[model samples]
Target: AGHSITTIEGLEKDNKLHPVQEAFVKEQAAQCGFCTNGLVMCAVSLLKINPDPDDQEIRDGLQRCLCRCGTQSRAIRAIKRVIG
Candidate 1:
């Protein structure tokens, strides 16, 4: 297969957190940490597809990643922060 793969770790460079990662941290989006990776990855993908997605679009984009710790609101806020 000639496909490229990117994991959450690949999002960082020069010891700096990606904007999405920084936003998530700033918003306190990770509660239990279990779903953080998936959420971050999904957010990255979502932004790649729609750089200026609205709130509803962000929610729809993250639907596939489940965060059982109830950090969805903060995560949404984080995404909005990245959007801005």
Candidate 2:
């Protein structure tokens, strides 16, 4: 699978965040928030490739992320809301 890596700083124009980032904030999903941006981007990108992924597929998508934050479930829920 081919994927493009987009940094948190590069996700916008005029030095602003993308809407997905904004949405994550709105959901209050950013506790500590250290890994929030990367998690959000990863979720968005994965859903674009596999919109209706099963639980195991979602886990596979996140396998390389190595999250320290405990917001994984929230991120997965957001992706499912969009794609499912």
Candidate 3:
């Protein structure tokens, strides 16, 4: 029960991927592409607080962000690289 929802199209404009979006593509993550945007947003928030998050920290961060395609593993990898 969140207050707002963000999407991939909303995350980018003028052909520029946000930092998290760039990280997502750079990591070769995202399968169905449904959760890509929200995942990226979550990544952004997480990185804002902890620029260097470990594996478990990432997994814990994304716990509530769900994807129908289940690309969690790939997303985690992307977040890790971006944070690092």
Candidate number that wins on TM-score, 2 or 3: 3
lDDT of 2 by residue, 10-53 (tens): 77878776666665665666766677766777766777798788
- Residue 45's lDDT within candidate 3 is 77
Least well predicted 10-residue stretch by lDDT in candidate 1? 65-74
Per the 3 Å backbone cut-off, how many clashing residue pairs does candidate 1 have?
0
What is the alpha-carbon lDDT for the whole of candidate 2? 0.70
Residue-wise C-alpha lDDT for candidate 3, range 1-84, written one tens digit per residue: 768755657768788987788878887777887777677878877887888888988888888787878788889988877766
TM-score of each: 0.95, 0.64, 0.73
Q: Return model 3's CA RMSD, one decimal.
A: 3.8
Sliding window of 10 residues with minimal summed lDDT for model 3: 2-11
lDDT of 1 by residue, 1-71 (tens): 89998999999999999999999999999999999999999999999999999989999988998777998
Which candidate order results from sorting by lDDT in descending order? 1, 3, 2
Task: Give candidate 1 misplaced runs (Cα > 4 Å).
Answer: none
